[model samples]
Target: MKVYISADMEGVTGLVDAEDVQPPGRDYERGRGMMTEDVNAATRGAFAAGAAAVLVNDAHGPMRNLLPDLLDPRALLIKGRPKPMGMIEGLDSSYDAVLCVGFHARAGVLGVLSHSFMGHEIEDIWLDDQVTGEIGLFEATASAYGVPVVLLTGDDTACAEAVAWNSSIRTVPVKYAKDRFAAQLVPVAEARSAIEAGAREALRSLPSAVGAGARTLSVRWQSASVVSHLTAIPGVARRDDRTVTVTADMPQLYRLFNLFLRVATAVTSNPPYC
Candidate 1:
């Protein structure tokens, strides 16, 4: 079986702030190593579960956070930006399962470094009027391709979020949140072991397929200017001064969400979580 892993930084082990996930800082540099180690753990678990191939996507801010040299040689890595599917890039029907590593809660939540796709720029997002975040969006999109999200690793809140979204998926929590920027973290070695074990068990007995279909996506931006810019795209409609809604099926809706991020990037210079 082929396994796909999407790696993000915010929910990585021992990370609790922007200084740890953002670039050009000593902490961020160290965090990258930690992120790579976590991905390696998950990859190792996938292989142990009898997976023949594994693909790991660097799904964080710049999408280049994972160190290629340090990554597990047995797994292929997808790095860099401008990807059509963003977090779920390279996901397709060929993969048997997906593993979301180091993901956090959505914006307005209390998970460590919590925010939606674009830090403070994206206030909220809804898929068919159900509040959604990166985790939910990725799972929904993956389902469209007939792939099951078997394993997820993150903080306790992130793990809980995953269970709430789909009860059957297995989760390993690396930390327990005390606040948005603070958490009681598990030791690095212990966290990785749990992640490895979780991945192994999750893949051992995969969940039944949960089908997908067309849905509407509504995004609320922190700035009206960002919303105004997005309306220029076809099928995007203004919902309010700071919100816009678009309807499309899996991959199309997923692509349009990325386009909205591009527009938001062009219009706003506000720092994330501001």
Candidate 2:
């Protein structure tokens, strides 16, 4: 079986602030090591569960947080940004399963480092009228490719979010959120153990198939200017002063969302979460 992993930094064990996940911060380097170790734990579990090959995509900001030199040699890594599929880059129908490592909860929720795709720029998102964060969006896209999300790792709220999206999917909580930038962490060793075990067990009883279909994706941004800029794109309509809606299938919908981010980035000068 083939396993795909999408690793994000904010939800990794021991990380509780932007300084921990964003670069140039005093602890960002240490956070990179922590992120790499978490991915390694998942990678080892995938192999133990009889995976023939594993591909990992660095899915955090900049998409370069994982240290390649320290990564598990058995799995291939996809690092860098501007990927067409973003977090789920390199994922496809051929993969048997997908694992989301170190993911935080969606914007407006109480979870460590909680924010949507573009940090605070995105106020909220809805997929076919269902409110969703990155977890739900990625899960939906993966399902479109016939790949089930077998396991997810993050804080307690993030884990719960995943279960809400798909109860059958297993989750390992590395920390308990006390606030958006603070959490009670699980010891590194203990968290890794749980993650490895969860991955092994999740893959053992794979679902027969994951249902997928075309849907509408709506994004609410923090700035009216961002929404105004996005409406310039074809097929994207203004939902309101600060919201835009688009209709598309998986992968395409996913790509369009990223394109919207690019446009927003070009026009907005405010930092994330400001």
Candidate 3:
């Protein structure tokens, strides 16, 4: 079976700051190492469950945090920015399972870093009238294609959110959150074991279920400026001052997401400072 792993950073076992996920910062390299080890743990678990192929997508910015040379030789790694699928890049229905590693709660979750896509620019994102963060929206999009998420890992808030989105899936929480940015963590070694075990269990009995079709997505921003910014896309329309709406079917969501993310990143972004 083929498996896809979408990996994020803020919810990684010890990650606590924005600087930690970006390169050249004092803590980024260490954070990236921690993220990779978590991915490796999941990858190993998938292998144990008889997966024939695995693909790891670096869902974080810059998208090059995972060291290609060190990733398990059994899987292919897609890294870097500007991919057509963005966070859900490199995914399709043919893949049997997906694992979301290190995702966190939506932008408003207390203490979590960059709670919104753009910390100061976006307020909330929604789908099916339900508020969602990267985790729910992405997973729901995957479900549109009949790809059920088999496993997920993150801090307590994230795992709880995942359960609400799709309770059938298994989750491994690496830390208990004091708030979004503050967390009491389980050591890396202990966290790694939980993630690996969960992945294996999830995939060992992968379900055969069809997806619920075509989804409409709404992104609520901090202000009208942000909404105006996203409406530049042809399919995107201003639903309100703080919201923009987009419509997409199974295949279309992936294509649209790439464009949506591009507009979002470009408009709300200020170049990084040292």
TM-scores of all predicted structures: 0.98, 0.98, 0.93
**lDDT of candidate 2 at residue 216, scale 0 to 100:** 95
**Which one wins by lDDT: 2 or 3?**
2
User: For residues 107-131, what per-residue lDDT tens digits would candidate 1 score against the true structure?
Assistant: 8888998889898878889999999
How accurate locally, in lDDT, is each candidate?
0.90, 0.92, 0.80
State the TM-score for model 3.
0.93
The residue-by-residue lDDT of candidate 3 on 22-74, one tens digit each, is 77778999898889988999999999999999999998878889887777888
Model 3 sits at a Cα RMSD from the real structure of 2.2
Question: Top lDDT: which candidate number?
Answer: 2
Query: What TM-score does prediction 2 earn?
Result: 0.98
What is the alpha-carbon lDDT of model 1 when measured against the actual structure? 0.90
CA RMSD of each candidate after superposition: 0.9, 0.9, 2.2
Model 1 Cα displacement at 15 (Å)? 0.7
Which parts of model 1 have CA positions greater than 4 angstroms off?
Answer: none
Residues forming the 10-long window of minimal summed lDDT in candidate 1: 205-214
> Where does candidate 2 have its weakest 10-residue lDDT segment?
205-214
**Alpha-carbon runs more than 4 Å astray in model 3:** 270-274
